[model samples]
Target: VTITDDSEDDCQYEEVAADDEFSIQEGDEDLPKALQTIQEHAEDAQILASQSVLLSEKSVSEVPEAVDDFLCNFLVRLGMSRTLDCFQTEWYELIQRGVLSAKDTGLVPSVYTRNQELEMENMHLKKDLENYKLAANKAKEALLKMQKERDFHRMHHKRVVQEKSRLICDIKRLKTHYASYEPVLKHLTEKYQTTLRQKMLTNLERDRAVGQITGLQAALQNLESG
Candidate 1:
């Protein structure tokens, strides 16, 4: 029994060695690719870590400007000497009395300053709105005046057109009235010419008749003498 067990154990050890050799050969082919991937990841981590530190330093440098310093700067910039003096007196008094602490005296948040800016902008916009309204009212009045003038001119033009129409009608009527008299004037001229010719013929016939009567009387006188 001991000899058979020893032989089985020897066969198992040889099979384990063969499996280990196969695994090593397969992993050796991909070792360089795995190392390159790990190297790229390490470089990316270093860049990210450096950028994070820069951003952290910048943010910290911007956050804690101390509320009192901000107020002093604001008052000085606005030229408020009396108000700044009063504020400093009160603020230092409170600080010496231990009524304020570092925790209570943080920087003024961006939200508050942004709100003040919005309020000032709103006031300016309201002023501009009022000015625009006044300008609009004046423009509306001017437009109304122009419209009134246009209406008056339109009415005047209509009256002038009516007057022209009436004048044209009167001219046409005068022409028709003159046309009625033209035929009567022509007939009167013909009658006057006929009367003048008859008068001339009657005068000639009377002269000839007078000459004949006188000759007959002379002829009778001659007969009596013979």
Candidate 2:
């Protein structure tokens, strides 16, 4: 069982890894929590940088056929490894003492081998199930984050829409407010045009009067010269 368990040493278990983080958090109450979290992630990132990740692969080991091997496998499958080690010592001693017959260490039945294989398969399935659950949890976290972002954007969009509506209303009010000046502006423009026309007519009349006066002066000079 130990051999089979160590067959693929992909990643080591770090079950007590959070103890260090908890200790740091407890020891440094004055430190900002965000800084502490950043430090933790930095250390984790260093581990990832230093080691090459090995992908986990499923492996099925064939159970040994011997009686002792079967008992060892059984104890290991049942998680009684300490007892199995002690029993192995006793088992060899009894064999050396000749208290056990040859049939005792003979080949085990096919059913026990099949059962052990089934147990191994069941263990693999449990591990796979755990991996699936972990993936589901990460996906759930991502989905929740996305939903929060969606809601945040939706809120911003609503604010923008409200702001846009307010601007539209303000523009409409400004148009109506300024609309009141149109008639006054028209009246002023007409009055300016009328004043300009009157000024132009006075200039033309003044020029004609000056021309008539000059003609009369020229006629008087001609008569006096005659």
Candidate 3:
């Protein structure tokens, strides 16, 4: 059997032997059926080979078209002309430096190194986040302490104010009581002074009466002697 690749640039064919060429015993009753099976297998293999060739050709033809479409959509339509130019320059440089070869179909070492750097940066960010959380916790604790202190001071001030108000009310009540008693105190002082003056006048009048009585008795004695 001969298989040809018609779509290829250098079309070629490979010769494969058909299964009928296999030797069989002439007197065997299953020889025809066995030959028919072998022939069918050979036909199937040829069909498979032809289909594989067609698929290969199709894949090869579509590669450039796919690349073109990707470039148009990513660079031209998105207006990334500078990025496209830079990518082309980098590709050329990579080719010239032999960094990009047939065996290497992916990004170069720098891309991998950048990925490592990004991972390190992520780790640093995680550490910073933890530190920030710790600081926030401390700050929250301090805020709670301050609030308690404020509440204590506010209560202390309120108690002091209440005490001061009580003192003021007591002072005002004392003054009012003093004012109500002032008139009675003054009247008692005047009555005591009048009673003392009347007692002194009564003593002076009794002494005068005693002196007059003594003088009359002396006159009676002189008349009896004469």
lDDT value, residue 20 of candidate 2: 57
TM-score ranking of the models: 2, 1, 3
Per-structure clash totals for the candidates: 0, 0, 0
lDDT of each: 0.76, 0.81, 0.71
How do the residues 1-226 of candidate 1 rate in per-residue lDDT, one tens digit apiece?
0011232343232233534323344445688775776676668768968997996566554453457876786688679999999999999999999999966665667676566558768889999999999999999999999999999999999999999999999999999999999999999999888888888888888888888988988999999998
Model 3 spans > 4 angstroms off: 1-115, 213-226
Model 2 agreement with the true structure over 142-224: per-residue lDDT tens digits: 99999999999999999999999999999999999999999999999999999999999999999999999999999999999
Candidate 3 structure quality by residue, lDDT tens digits, 1-226: 1122433655467776653445454676796787896787778878988998998776564332222234434476458989888877876688789987654433234444456458668889999999999999999999999999999999999999999999999999999999999999999988888878887887788788778878877888888887
Better of 2 and 3 by lDDT: 2
Clashes of 2: 0
Which runs in model 1 stand beyond 4 Å of their true positions?
1-106, 205-226
